[model samples]
Target: MGFLQQKNSADDSIVARIATLVLRLILVVAIPLIAFAVLYAGFIFLRDGNAPKWVITAVAIIWGVGGVAALFWIFNWIVELFSDTWRARLQPFVFVGPALAILAWYLAIPVGRTFYISLFDRDGPGTGQFIGLANYATVFTDRLMREAFRNNIFLWIIFAVPLTVGFGLLVAVLADRSRFERTAKALIFLPMAISFVGAGVIWNFIYVVRPPDTEQIGLLNAIIVNLGGTPRFWPAHTAIAPWNNLFLVIIVAWLQSGYAMVLFSAAIKGVPVEILEAARVDGASEIEVFFKIMIPTILGTIITVTTTVVIFTLKIFDVVWVMTGGQFGTGVIATQFYRQSFIARNAGLGAAIAIVLLIAVIPVMIYNLRQFREQEAF
Candidate 1:
C-alpha cells in the first residue's frame, strides 16, 4: 500500500511538471505575438490622416525590433530555466517537431503521393480512372519507355559497375602511396566537385559535332579527324551515341574513383603486413599477391564499394539529363522519371518508374548493409 501510494505520488508530480512546462512554452511564444498584435493595433488606431512620417517610422521600428528582441529573450529564458527533466524530454520535440512536420509534409508526403499515383491513370491533372497495373504495364510495353528502361539497366550493368569498381580499384592500386598520389587523387576527384549539369556541359563540348566539310571543334572529333577517320556527328548518331554515354560515365567514374580509392587504400593498408611477407616467402608473384591476398582480404570493402556505386548508377540522372535529355538512347531511370512526370505530363508512368528505381535500390542497399555487418563481424 505504501509503494502504491509512492508510485501515485510520482505520477502526479510528473503530470504537474509537464503541465507547468507546457504553460511556460505557451507564454514564451504568446507574449511576443500578443505584443506585436497590440502594437500593430495601436499603429492602426493612431493613424490620423497620415500623422508625421517620423512618428510612423518610429512606431514601425519599435514594433519590428522590439518584437524580435522579445521573442529571442523569451525563448532563451524558457530554454534556460524551465528545462528540467520533463522539459528536457519535451524540449527536443520543441526544436525537432517543426522539422519532422516539414519533412513529412514535403518529402514523405510527396513520396507517398507518388506511390499512390502509380496505382491510378493520372497524368499531371485529374485521376482519369483506377488502372491497377496498367501504368506499370505501359512502362514495359511502350517502346520509348521500354527502351529507356533497357538503357537504364544497361547503364547499371555495363557502365556504372565497371567504371566505379574496376577503374577505381585499378587507380587505388596504382596510386597508393605513389609520388603523385595527392595530385593524382585531386585531378581524379575534380570532376566530382563539378555539379552534374556542369560536368554534362563540359562533356557536351568534347562531344560537339561539326559538318564533315567544317573543321572539327570537338576534341574527340578533332582527334578522330587527325587520325584520318571521318568526323561524325557524335551526339546525333544512335549507333555511336551509347558509347558516348560511356564518356559521361567516365566523368562520374573519375570523380568517384578518388572516393573508392580512399576507402580501398585504407582497407589495403589494414591488411596485415605479416600476411604479405608470408606470401612473399612462398614465392607469390606481386600480381598474384594482389589478386589472391589483398583482394581476398578486402573482399568486404570491395563489395561495399561496388554496391555503393550500383546505387549511384541506379539513380544516375543529372549527367544523362543534361547531356542527352533522355535522347539518343542514353536515358537512365531517374531521368526517365523526370521526363515522364514533367515533360510528358504522365505522373502515373513516372511513379511506376520511380517505384522500379526504388525496388532496384532497396536490394542493393540491403546487400551493402549486410556486407558492412559482415565486415564488422570479421
Candidate 2:
C-alpha cells in the first residue's frame, strides 16, 4: 500500500507538469493572434473614419496599447515555460525577435525591392523587363550623373568631413577652456536643433541676391553693399558656379558641426588627465600636447564622426532641394536620385543612384563597426 501511494503521487506530479506546459503553449500561440486581430480591427475602423469620435479614441487606446502589452507578455510567458537552461538560451530571442521582424519588414524588404527595381528600364512600368547592368552603365556614363557624383565627392571630402570635423574640434577645445563653457557650447550647438529645410530657408535669406540696382535684402549681400561692393547672384555667378556646391556644403557643415562637437567633446573628456599632465611636465607646449596626445587618443572618435558626416553628405538632399532645387551645379547623389525617380519618372536611374549611394556608405559603415569592435576589445 505504501509503494502504490508513492507511485500515484509521482504520476500526479508528472500529469500536472504536462498540463501546465500545454496551457502555456496554448496561451503563447493564441494571445498574439487575438491581440493582432483586435489591433487590426481598430486600425480598420480608424481608417474608415466613420466611427464615433469617442469610440475611435477608446479603440485606439485599448487596441494599440493593450495589444503591444499582450504581445510582450506572451513572449515573456514563452521564456518562462522553458527549463532553466532552455530559458537562458531562448530569452534573448524572445526579447530580440520583434525588433528583428520589424527590421526585416521595413529595411530588408525595401532594400531588396530597390535592387530589383534597379535592373529595369526607366520608362517601363512595374519592375520593367530586366535589362541587367544597363541602368548602372547609364549612371556611370551619363554627364549629369557624373557631375552629381563629383559634387557628392566634393561635399563628402571637402566640406562635410574635414570642415565639420575641424570646426567641431576647434569649438570643443576652446569651449572646454572657456570660463562660460556651457554657454559657449550651447550657443555653438544650437544650429543642430534646426531641421535641414529650416536651416536652408534661414540661410537662403543670408545668401539671397536681387537686381544689382535694387536694395540688397540678403544679409550677406547687404553687408557687401554696405562695404561698397556690388551685389551679385552668389549662387549663379559663372565664375563661382562650380564652387556654389560649397555654399550648400557650408549650410550642411553648420548644422553638422554641433553634432561633431558633442561627440568630440565627450571623447576629449574621456582622455586621461594624468597623461596630459605628464606631457606638460616634460616641457611639451599646449599645441604639442594637443596634437600628439589629445588627437591620437581621440583618433577613433574623429574617424567615427567624419565617417558619419560623410554618409550624411552622400545622401544630402534637403538643403540642395530647398535652396537651389539641385540647380546651379549643387546637385548631389540624393537629389539626383529624387529627380530621376520622382520628378523625371526614371525609376531605374533613381534606383541605380540610390544603390551607388548605398555602396559608398557601406565602406564607412564597415570601418565604424571595426572601430566599435576594437573599442569593445580594449
Per-residue lDDT of model 2, residues 39-91, tens digit only: 88779868788878898888788879878887888778867887664454445
| C-alpha-based local distance difference test score of model 2 | 0.81
Which candidate has the top score in TM-score?
Answer: 2
**What is the C-alpha lDDT profile of model 1 across 1-378, one tens digit per residue?**
454322323445767767856765565445545656766776676675477989878877887777656755555466557535445444554455444655766677877787788987755336456788888888788887777767666755577677777777787788875999878867876666788888778878887878878899999999998898887656556787557566667767765776787788778879999999999999999999999999999998998888777777778888777777878877777887898888887778889888878777878768768769989964
Question: Model 1 segments beyond 4 Å from truth?
Answer: 1-9, 12-85, 95-99, 124-127, 240-244, 365-378
- The residue pairs in collision within model 1 are none
Candidate 2 stretches greater than 4 Å from native:
1-40, 50-66, 74-93, 123-127, 236-239, 369-378
Backbone collision tally, model 1: 0
What does candidate 2 score on TM?
0.80
Q: What are the lDDT figures for the candidates, one per model?
A: 0.74, 0.81
Error of 2 at 324 (Å): 1.3
Q: Give the range of the ten consecutive residues with the poorest summed lDDT in model 1.
A: 1-10
